[model samples]
Target: MKLGVVGKGGAGKTTVAALLAEAYVAEGRRVVAIDTDSNPNLGISMGLSLEETEAVPVLPRSMLVGVQGDVTADELIGEYGTDTPVGATLLSAIKVTEAGAGCTCGGHATVRSLLSDALADRADVTLIDMEAGLEHLSRSGGTLAHADVLLVVMEPSRKGVLTAARTLPLAEELGIPFTVGLGNKAKRPDDRRFFEDLCAEHGVPLAGVVPHDDDVVAAGRTGRCLTASSAPAVRAEIDAVIAHLDALTG
Candidate 1:
């Protein structure tokens, strides 16, 4: 499965991507997790220490500039991918490290090429933590174009829902086969219902809900990997969400 997880900032898309990658790893699947965010942090979320995450090499902008899309799966991954503690290979797409780093158009092109290449078939599961918001979908040769499924995560807020609402049609425009809306961080009685109704009203297919959990917050504070044992309830919801995705895509 080639899955892309996207959302507005703070909508828990990174958390969702990390959880899904780890969950698939636990199921004995070969997984590759790609972080396409300019502010990349999926490495740390996947259990790499801060130093390790920083040290993981990102796809160089120079190599990607005017890329001919000729690289093979093994070549690209073997050269740049790093192994995470959770048994998944992690690849960082782009990071603005210097003052005059040019625009990330090349980085987006590289990710788009990677997703469409044989890399899609090389892993049992390939998950991309796409750049936040609708810009990615709007760009030509965007990263998620070839994704088998796109998870549009939304928080319990109007802006979050609006982002998801705007993203669903763009996913279709990109010819992504499946796109679903996920509600995250629902704390109040109406929070879950709020997203549910808004998604329904906006024609966004509902996936599943992950409620607000202190364990997630605590794990972030301690700089630790959130495991199924650490946050069983959230993991349970994520597992169900994965199952829902499976049923839809399969």
Candidate 2:
């Protein structure tokens, strides 16, 4: 099951993705949580120590360029796939550099290559924490072209809900069979209801909700991993979302 998790910048996509990765790992599945976000902090969320995250090898410059002018996806993954903690293999689309260079074509090229290939097939549950918004889709239609599902996370606002609504058709057009709305950062019970109602009114499929919790915020602030969080409520919400997805995909 290849899953794509996308949302606004602060919508907790990485947190949810990490939870899903760990959930599937606990289920004894081979889970590869691809951190396609350019910022590349999904490792921290997935329980990688600061040192390990710093040591993650970026997709080499050589991998992006070749004699044919663009290396094949197989070549990139074969050489650059980095395994992380918790039975998950991770690949960052962004190359880590001290130079802080501009124009990230190499990163996008790596993403495009991976998407063009069925690279997610390497694991039992391939969960991708995508960068914020839907530009990644437009930029790599072939990657998501036959995806199993997409979980569009939202913050329970009009724009968030409507943007998720607008994304459904594009996912469908990309040949993604299933897409659902995931309400994240809901501060109250009614927040979930509001998200569902908005989805229903706007034609988006509201699959499930993850409530607001200080544990999540604290982990984000301190750079600690969600796998280390003591909060079960946040985890329970993720499990519920995954359960719903399992039923849908099965």
Candidate 3:
């Protein structure tokens, strides 16, 4: 299954994505968690230490500019562009953590193509932690176009629900078949009902509600995966979300 996670900045999208990836890995599936957000902290959330070796080779300078509409697709994919190290270049484009001169040009299309090709090969699951909002969708040419499921993470705040509502139209335009709302960082039992009613009122599928957990906060602060923390509540919530996703895509 291919899943894309999106939300407003600081909405815990990366945390959820990392947990989802960890869940898939625990199921013995070959998973590739793509951090497509400029924040570049998804890997840190997944407990992956950033290293020079993990640096995805950069795309050719000419191809980078072409992605932003400076050139045609044919030209960008021409012989010179073909020299890009397939997955590495694509990942590097989206991998925000790498610190050389930033890719000011748009390479999201190339990133999407590479990700699609990689998924087609043999990955059991590909989870993409998309940049904060729906902007990436257009930039990447509906990279989430073929995603089996699209997950929008929200907190219990009014702003969070509003942001999810704002992103819905874009997901619809992109032809994402299934879209679900996940309530994260719920501090009170009443918040759960609030999110449920909000989802119902908004016509969004309610996947799961994850309570606010201190372990999650600690994990984030330490740049560690919450999966390894001895927090049953957090784990159970993530497992529930995974189960819902499985049932939706089954």
Measured by lDDT, the strongest candidate is 1
Candidate lDDT values, in order: 0.85, 0.75, 0.68
The TM-score that candidate 2 achieves is 0.85
lDDT of candidate 1 over 139-237, digit per residue (tens): 886668989999988999888888878887888889999989999998998987898788888888889989889989887788778887888888898
TM-score, each model? 0.94, 0.85, 0.79
lDDT of 3 by residue, 1-250 (tens): 8888988888899888877777677777766566666546665666545553255343343233233444443443333221111121123345444579576334565455544444444457777778887677675467677677889999898777777787678788888778888999999869999998888887777799888989889887776656634567877888899899899888
Candidate 2 lDDT by residue in tens digits, 66-175? 33446554565566666767568777766436575765555665554454444544567777788888887786434455468999989878888887988898888888
TM-score of 3: 0.79
Between candidates 1 and 3, the one scoring higher on lDDT is 1
Model 2 whole-model lDDT (C-alpha atoms): 0.75
Cα deviation at 63, candidate 2, in Å, is: 5.5
Please state the error at residue 227 of candidate 2 in Å.
Answer: 2.3
